[model samples]
Target: MPHVEKAVKDWQQQFAGLKTSAANLMQIAFPPLEIMQSPTGCCETRLHWQDQDSEASGYVCIDDFVQATLQFENVPHSVAGQALDEVFGLGWFNGAELGVRQAGEGVYYWTDETNAAEWEVSVLPGGLANLSIEYTNAPDIATLLDALHTAYEDPHEDDAAT
Candidate 1:
């Protein structure tokens, strides 16, 4: 009816849609299938995860958070350090209060998932980034580090499902 009302309605609908998506993902992740969505949302629409290739790491999850199988491989930790620095500086973590840690001389890690947008991600290390992040505290410190360590340890066996 009014401009302000229309904007509010639109925003509400968008939030509702996100909720529905989260519910759907929860159903798939923890219920009849227990499979997760790829960063691409490929298996999510089908209610099952596609067969994962060996590229880095693996993951297990619930609606709230994910647990990664940390075993990284074939990573140029030195190079990745710079790459990740650039990544963290771009998004919410850019000026956020959350802390980013250096796992080693060339490896970095951030345990904060506070600013992850639903269905937002560009790259996944150890399949640790969520495709649809609904909870601010998803993948707490230990779990995130596990995945990071795993992915870096055996980068070939990891997949993007977190």
Candidate 2:
């Protein structure tokens, strides 16, 4: 797909501007099975996870728009396997320690020791050619510190009881 290639090239250009090298940009081949059917068309893309100067930071580039949904046509078991393989191949999550959970209908969560991120991929309920991704940034160091203080504080005053 030309669009898919263009998307990958665009990402590479952006990365180059940041003085970063995207060592790996693999193409996810279409699945052999049909799990969900998309009347229009379906395409797959790849993402990379890199360490930013020893900090735990990463970016996920969806071939389509950041707010696009993921759909399959007559999605089969093989497709699901391929999809999981593609996601994990990016090394977005650590091999063993990372947690991947499905929080809701089309929503998934990825969390490691230092960071957490959520992804929602699904087809538009009806037959619409659109997708979406809603991402919420994990709490920063300051936010976590404030939460720790609140956790240790007592909710009641002992003087009143005395």
Candidate 3:
């Protein structure tokens, strides 16, 4: 297997624009490996973390990152089909519909099928366009942010003399 630590760092570099510091990125499990595949084909990755908020009632905190069917069936296939294949790969069908939801203190990427990829780009709570790219492997959230930021940043350099 590739060096997971390096991979995580690489991902961080790719998404530095999101302002995701190494400290914040290190808080979550790295290279979210798949733990199990249910009979229905749903996959789940377990993230283990210690709740820093001592005031909370819970002791150990475990977050389940689940991937199911896509949630947005109403979205035309024509829009998602080619894009999905190009970004993910061939043979990986759109298992779940794509949709967004606020879960706990953060947002999660969800699908309607047991196995599928979801892509969503929207303005986040802070007014930054949050672009999410999710796949079977670790979703490169940082890379997406960096790319989006670079794409949208004002290109014109201040040249008052011109």
Top lDDT prediction, candidate number: 1
Q: Which candidate should be chosen as best, given TM-score against the real structure?
A: 1
Model 3: lDDT equals 0.29
Q: What lDDT is reached at residue 130 by model 1?
A: 27
lDDT score, candidate 3, position 143: 33
Candidate 2 lDDT over 1-162, as tens digits, reads 999999999987785543212112111121111222223233232232232232222222332322222222222212222333334433343331222111112333334333233332232222111112223221221122232223223222231111
Model 1, span 40-114: residue lDDT tens: 232222233222343323232333123122222333432233233334432333332221222322222234444
Higher-ranked by lDDT: 2 or 3: 3
The deviation in Å at residue 108 for candidate 2 is 4.5
Instruction: Score residue 131 of candidate 1 by CA lDDT.
Output: 26
lDDT of 3 by residue, 90-152 (tens): 333223233121111123334425435465433233322232434422334323223322322
Report lDDT per candidate: 0.34, 0.27, 0.29
RMSD of each: 12.6, 18.9, 16.0
Q: Tell me the lDDT of model 1 at 159.
A: 23
Worst 10 residues of 2 by lDDT: 22-31
Q: How many residue pairs clash in all the candidates, one count each?
A: 24, 20, 21
